[model samples]
Target: MHRFKGRVGLCAMVALGVVTACGGSPDPARPAGEKQQEQQAASRSGEASPGEDRAVTWANDYCGAVSELVRSVSEMPIIDASSPRRASETSGELLKVMVGGLDRTLDRLDNLGAPPVDGAERVRRDAVATYADIREHAQAALSELSAAEGPEASRDAVSSVRKPLDDLGGVDLLAGFDTVPALQEASRQAPACRTLTDADPDPRIDSPGS
Candidate 1:
C-alpha cells in the first residue's frame, strides 16, 4: 500500500505530460488584405481549407480523447486502508474505471485514422502500442487485486497497479513530436489540448474538506 501511494501520486503528473499547444504569432509583415482573403476563402469553403480542416479535426479529436483518459484516471478514489475489504473494494472499482477509460481511449486512437503531418502513421502506431501495453498492465493488476485475499496480498496487488501508473507518469507527449514541427503546430492550434497547459504540475489531493 505504501508503494502504491508513492506511484499513484504520479498519475496526475503523467497525465499532465501532454504538450500544451500555443496559438501561433500573427505575421507582422503580411497584408491585412491577404488575411481577409484567406478568411473569405475559408468561409466560402464551409470551414477551413481541406488540409487545414483535417489537421484541426485530428488534433481536436486526439486532445479530447486524451482529456477523457486523464479525467477518468484522476478520479481514482482515495483508498481507506484501515479495512482490508474496503481497500480492496475501492481499489477494484478504480481498476474497473481505469480499464474502461483505457478501452475507450484505445478505440478513439484506433479510429483517429492518422495525424495530419509527416510520419503520422509511425506516431499513431507508437501511441496505440504504448497505450495497449498500459491497458494490459491495468487488466493484470485488476486480476491480481481480485485474487488477493488478505492484507499482504491486497497490498501486493495494489503495488502491481501502481507500477503501471508510475510508468504512465513518465510519458512525455512532446518527446514523441521532437522531429515533427507541423504536428506540434497542429497541437498548438487545438483548443482541446489546452488542458495540458492548465494542468497542475504538482497536484495534491485534499482529504474530504480538510
Candidate 2:
C-alpha cells in the first residue's frame, strides 16, 4: 500500500505503517453536534483579552488535543495484504480510526472555545474547517472501501484510502494559530506541545484536536 507523503499532520508519521487500526470514539459526555452549538454560543459571547496565562492555557489545550489525535492514529493495525478480504476489512478499519479520531479532535478543538488572540474567531473557523475537510476525505475513503468487493476491486479500493490520508499529510493543522505571534510563542511553552515536538520534530500543524 502507498504510504502518506512527507510532513503533513502527525498522522503522517505513522501513515507509513500498514495494517488495521481502530478506536477513538468522540467524547461520550458531549453528544454529537453539541460542540457546534456550544461554539456558536461562545462566539456570540464576544472575545476576551486573554493575559499571558490564558494564552498559555489556550496553547496547551491545543497541543494536548493534537497529541491525542496522533496517539489515536498511531493505533491503526498493520494491514495483512496476504488475504484480500482481510486486507480490505483492515483497511476499512484504519479509515474508521482516521474518521473517528478526526471527529473527536474537532470536538476537542471546539471545546477549547476561541483562542485568545486578535482574529481568533477567523483562525478558529479556518482551522476547524481544514480538519473537517480532512475528516470528510477520510469518510469518503471509508465509504469507498466499504463498497469494494473481489480481490482486484478490493485492492483498488484499499489503495484509494491512501489519497485522503495523503491529503491530510499535506495539511498543517497548526498553521492557523501562527497568525498570532503571542499564541505561537505560548505554544512553545506548553508541555503538551513539547511532547508533540518530540514525537515529530517538524513544525506542528492543526489536527482535529489541536
Candidate 3:
C-alpha cells in the first residue's frame, strides 16, 4: 500500500477502547470515495438486526484497519526509503490490525450477545488477551517504525507485525467464524473502509462469506 494509506485509525481505541476524543477529518479532496464507503459501512451496522450485518461489517472494518497497516509497512522504504520517513508515518495502517481485530471481535460479541454468565467469563478474558495481543504487536511495530529511519529497519519493523497476525489467522474465533472467513468478511465490509483502512480490501468473493 502507498504511504497515504499506510497509517491506521484509532476507531476502536477512541470509540470502544479508551475515553473518547474528537478530531477533524482527513483531506477532503484526497478522496471522498473512502469516506463514503466508511459511512456506508457504519450505516450498515445500524441497518440490520444486531447480528445480521454488524458481525460482517465490524469484522471487515477491523481487519481492514490492520491490512492497511500491513500494506503500509509492505510499501514502506524504497529499499532506499528513509527510516524517519517510514516511521513518522503508519498510525493509519499499522493500528488498523488491532482496530480491525477488535471490530471483528465486537461483531462476534454482538452476534453472540455476550457469552453465558458462567463460562462466558473465560471468553471475555480470552478476548481481552487476544485484543491485547493485537494491540501490543501493532504498537510495537509502529513504535519501531517511528523511531527508525533506515529502509531495512522500517521494513523489518513493519514486517514484524505480520507474524503475530498470521498466527491469529483461522482461529475459528467468534463461534465458528474461522479466521479466514472473518478476515475476508472484515476485508469486504465496506468500500470506504477498503478504500482507506485496507491495503488490499478486495473481496474474496470466491467464498460466499469472504
The numbered model that scores best in lDDT is: 2
TM-score, candidate 3, is 0.36
Q: Assess each prediction's global lDDT (C-alpha) against the native.
A: 0.61, 0.64, 0.44
Q: Which residue pairs clash in candidate 1? A: 21-188
Once fitted onto the true fold, the runs of candidate 3 whose alpha carbons sit more than 4 angstroms away are 1-92, 100-117, 175-210
Better of 2 and 3 by lDDT: 2
- Tens-digit lDDT string for candidate 1 (98-169): 778678777877888556777666766787787788789879999999999888998888777675566555
lDDT-better candidate, 1 vs 3: 1
So what's the TM-score on candidate 1?
A: 0.68
Q: Please provide the root mean square deviation of candidate 2 (C-alpha atoms, Å).
A: 15.7
Taking the tens digit of each residue's C-alpha lDDT, what string does model 3 give over 1-210?
123433344344222222111266566575778776865776676543334344445554444433333333333333223543543454325455344545554444434434312344354455556655655665666566667667677666666655445544423233222334533453345443455433332321110011
In angstroms, how far off is 161's CA in candidate 2? 0.3
